[model samples]
Target: MRILVTNDDGIFAEGIYDLAKALQDIGEVIVAAPNSERSATGHAITIHHPLRVDKVRFFDTTIEAYSISGTPADCVKLAVEALLKDRRPDIVISGINNGPNLGTDVIYSGTVSAAVEAAIMDIDSIAISMGSTNITQYTDAANFVCRIAKEIIHNNDIKDTIININYPTCPKEEVKGVKVTTLGVRKYENTFIERKDPRGNSYYWTSGNVVDMEQNQDSDILALQNGYISITPIHFDLTHFKTFEKIKKLNFQK
Candidate 1:
């Protein structure tokens, strides 16, 4: 099996390294990611400027990796379209992201965007994240992906759905189990601090406090809060089928 690994965090991030290293035993792992961090850069592709790629030494050349000047979506697009064009990978795994991408956070997540890109190309993908920012280990997350990837590759039932997973920061032993869940609501108390630069130029720095707004018992957010790994299968179709007729009722002309 061949796998394409990527992340929104720059290639140097510990999460991606641990993930790629762990998956090496499973298959040929290719790492193509942004040279610098591109966190929260959703579904964006760089088209105006010519992309630059550098063949960097990662893991002593045992695995092929490249640092590209683009977002997470760009990395996956370039890898499949150009870098590995001759032999496309069977699956694309977009993270062991530095932080959890749950509920509405996936909308702005570069990590999830990479997986979405793969799904667009009709390839199975998984976006795995760790729920805690204070943790250092990613082995459990990596191992979990390996196990799930085997099921996805051989099982056609899981096709066309992008798997979104979030493992809590607690130790592996503390994890209760996996929960198949729905997208939950996550909000933030957004704040922007106004400050003056050394040259007296005023600018605003972005910051926010995350708020768990999920009240549903079967939501991914609630599952993570209860010490369980949350796995939410998502599809790209944005049609609100439930409200399709509601909007159609406001019919204008034929």
Candidate 2:
């Protein structure tokens, strides 16, 4: 079993390293990640600039790792297309992400986007995230990730879906259990702060607090908030079949 591990967080981030270490016992782990933090970068792939990859020392001597100068999506693209050209990985796992990618947050998350890219290429993929900003809970998240990956690798019925998981910020014992959920909506109280530079030039900094808009009981955000791991299956097909049929019923100028 070969696994390609990646993260929106830089190659040196604690989350990625911990995840890699956890999965090393499972199979051959090869890591390809951004050279710097690329959080919330979405599914952007580089087509203009030339990408650069360099071997980096991650764990003392276990997994083969590389630092990539591109987005999270680019790492997976280059890994399969360039690095592991002869042998495609059996599965791709993106992140024990430093933060949660619940609800609509996945739309802007490079962590989840990396997994989406793998799914686009018809590869089995999963994205793991921890709800807390603290790094201490990553082990618990990694354990769950390992479990899911093992299940997918051994089970054939689990194909055709990208698994998105989020672990709450609590002790492993406090976790209730895993909950299969749907995507919830989350809005943010966006704010911009203006400051003066050394030359008295005005600069603006963008920041926002994520507003809790969760009302659905079976939502990913709600599940995580209630101390349960959230698992949401994501797919790339954006067609609104119901809406398409409704529109098709309308007679227009053909």
Candidate 3:
């Protein structure tokens, strides 16, 4: 099996390295990611500037890797359309991210966006992230990714779906179980810190306290909090069918 591994944590990040290394046991891993951190860069593709890709020797060359001067979405899009067009990968795995991409925050996650890009191309994908900031637990997450990938390879029913996996902060042994969950409400309070630059220029830094408003237990947020791994099947289609049906009742003339 050929796996295209990627992340928003940059090519040099240890998270990607650990992921690529661990994934090698399952398949041929080719990593294409941003040269610098592109965290929270949604589904943006570079159009104004030429995307520059550089061949790099990552982790002793067992894993073929490239660094792109763009966002996470750009990396996977370019890889599928240009880099690996001759032999498309069996699966696209985006992350082993150092942070959690739970709830509605997936909308802002470059890691998840990478997988979404793959789904747009009709390729099976997985977006894996650690629920904690700790990098030490990436091994457990990567192992879980292999198991999930191997199992999902045969189940094409959810062919266009993106499996979003978030590992809990606790140790692997302590993990309760896996929970199939839905996206929950994760909003942040709009608060910014005004600061002065070295030249005394005013700058505003955006920092908001997270406000989770999920009342249901079937949410990814709640599952993670309950010490279980959260696996959410997500897609790029944002059409609300009920809302569409409601609007159709109005029957406005074109």
Candidate 4:
């Protein structure tokens, strides 16, 4: 089996590197990721500027890697369309992201976007994230992802959905179990922070704190809060099913 591994955390991130190493024993691993961190970039693609891909050495692994001047989605697009045109990978796995992609956070995550892009291309894909800012060790997350990837590659039923997994920031033994969940709501305290440059020009920075929600046992947030790995099946479709019938009932000009 051949696996295409990518992430929003750049090619040299510890998370990506660890994940690649772990999967190497299972299959041929290929790393195609951003040259720099592109966290929270969503599904944006590069349109105007010409994209450049450079091959560089990352740690001990002499893997063929690329650094593209684009978003995470663009990296996956360019990889399949241009880089790996001759051989299509069996699956695409994005991230062991620096932080968890729970609740509405997935909407803005480039880590998840890369996986979504792969799924749009009709390949099985998954986005893996660790629910912590301080990521000292990634082995546990990598192993967990490897186990899921193996199951996904073999099972036809699991291939029908795109997976977004979030691991809590605790010892593997402390993890209760895995929970299949839905996206949760994340209210924010603030969206932006105003700052002044040394030249006195004012600029805004995006920063916010996660808002607590009332206990909803089925949500990703709640699952993570309770020390369980959250696996939320995500899709590219943005149709609001609840509002669809209501909108259909409204009469409009023919």
- Prediction 1 TM-score vs. true: 0.96
- What TM-score, computed on C-alpha atoms, does each candidate reach? 0.96, 0.95, 0.95, 0.95
Residue-by-residue lDDT tens digits, candidate 3, 175-248 = 99999999888888988889999999999989887885754789998998899999999988999987997887
- Model 2 global lDDT (CA atoms, 0 to 1): 0.90
Worst 10 residues of 1 by lDDT: 55-64
Per-candidate local distance difference test: 0.92, 0.90, 0.90, 0.89
Q: What TM-score would you give candidate 2 relative to the actual structure?
A: 0.95
lDDT of 3 at 140: 82
Residue lDDT tens for model 2, 176-247: 998999988988999999999999999999999988573699999889888899999989888998799899
The candidate scoring highest on TM-score is 1
> Which ranges of candidate 3 are over 4 A from the true structure?
197-201, 251-254
Alpha-carbon error at 162 in model 2, in Å?
0.9
Error of 4 at 209 (Å): 1.3
Clashes of each: 0, 0, 0, 0
Which residues of candidate 1, in runs, are more than 4 Å off? Answer: 198-200
lDDT of 4: 0.89
**C-alpha lDDT of residue 234 in model 1:** 91
Please, what's the RMSD in Å of model 3?
Answer: 1.6
Q: List the residue pairs that clash in candidate 4.
A: none
Per-residue C-alpha lDDT of model 4 across residues 127-199, encoded as one tens digit per residue: 9999878766899989989999999988887654679999988988899999999999877787878899999
